[model samples]
Target chain A: MVEIEIDEDACVGCGSCVDDCPNDVYQMNEEKWKTEVVKVEDCMACLSCHEICPAQAMEHRDIHVAKRLYIDRKVNDVLDKII
Target chain B: MDMEIEEIRGTFRPELIPKETGGDIEDYEEALHVLMKFVGSMSSALEQVSGRGANAIVYQAGKRMGHDAAKMMEKTDNLEQAMKEMGEVLGVEFYFEMWKPSDQEGYTIEKGNETVVKLLFMDCVVRQTLRRTGLPQKGPLCYLLYGYMVGAVEEVMSIKGKLDIDHVGPNACLKTLTIKWGGK
Candidate 1:
């Protein structure tokens, strides 16, 4: 099962997610002008909404996170120390 | 910034197989990154030189490889069974599963002589390589996996098949695989 959360404060109501999601997992709350998850059952956790969301308001939980082997560990290590 | 290089000397014989592989995890990571860069460069250069023809070349190469890999597998007419076998063949590097919408009762839909199934690719090396090289998705490189899946399915089911990308994301990608029942 996939759980999605949208921070209302962060949501700008751009409807980017609503348009970008192929599965129709999200819809804009027209009254509140915020984004909401409408069809949670169909969400595949592709995270395209997360990428397109300017405010970064959405979060997905309990989904299979794909492996990110492209990241350079040494660069991250250096940044960890500096930050 | 400076590192030490360790060298191993061993005698090699055709009949004797080495039980252990040389180099550590770091070496492997370095090698993997280098290969990704090399492949990325090749894909980009090929695209620039060959234009759209690059995709066909890469797809043919992948199809040949897929056919070769599927040669040892058992042939079957069942799409689901063939998908299971393909999952094992693809392994974790290109992990994928049949997907369907909540409203759909079955994973597959039949339309006349054609059967269509949605595939959700969760982990993919081509995606990783593209990200590593800062290349966009749906390029010629993506056709490699497309051809691979189509080729494998064709070999396993003895039917003509095609795969189409529906969407691409950082974590996952969705594709549609259609098989023609008597198109072999």
Candidate 2:
């Protein structure tokens, strides 16, 4: 089951990835189409969306890495000021 | 500087700290170093690319895009070579030149005599895939890439307190070169 993850902050709502994916795996969410896990078996693991993400946002991971990276930005912002 | 950084780190993004690069500003600095190395390597490789007389312009955008990511990611693979090989496989040739305000071909100012580095990169040809994709077309790419580099220096790098970008290309023949800042 391929899970969909969206970092709304990074999702510029550009919708480029939606056009690139062939498996119909993503869709527009709240107008942005920010990385929806629409299909499980269809994922080709092409990394097209990953490479194309201009904001360094979005990724297909084993759910764990996805969750961790999702929070990394916020953490980095706080830590960046101190250590 | 250390004390100043500590004060700044006090307001950092806590969540990003532990996961990506061990939660420290020190690590972040190290990451930026790595990222710059990657970018430099990419820039160097671009010098060899030819662009096949295809009428193209290439430049780096989102000034911090390459820098911030470069600082964090640890690349074990030869991406420089990989990018080169990717060009070969795709039958596209590219060229790039990295600059600083102090280098040769470096323009000189009249009165103040202050030298400032204006970083830039340009492509010699537009790729077939890009042409078909309906992304921002080449003309806009030229405009934005130039503006983006100025943003990088003035905003991201914080080298200059304030700077403005100026463009001077879309030449009579095949290409365009945008000049950033007030020319000499």
Estimate TM-scores for all models.
0.95, 0.24
Each candidate's interface RMSD (Å, one decimal) is 0.5, 19.6
Model 1 lDDT per residue over B1-54, tens place: 787777888877755655555778988899999999999999999999999999
DockQ of each: 0.88, 0.01
Off by over 4 Å in 1: B1-17
Error in Å for residue B13 of model 1: 7.4
lDDT tens digits, residues B77-105, model 2? 23233223322322222233323222235
lDDT, candidate 2, A15-82, per-residue tens: 77777664566676765546565664555344456656688667566421211111245457779999
Mark the 10 consecutive residues where model 1 chain B has the least summed lDDT: B13-22
Q: Write the residue-wise lDDT of candidate 1 on A1-83 in tens digits.
A: 99999999999999999999998999988899999999999999889999999999989999999999999898899999999
Top-lDDT candidate index: 1
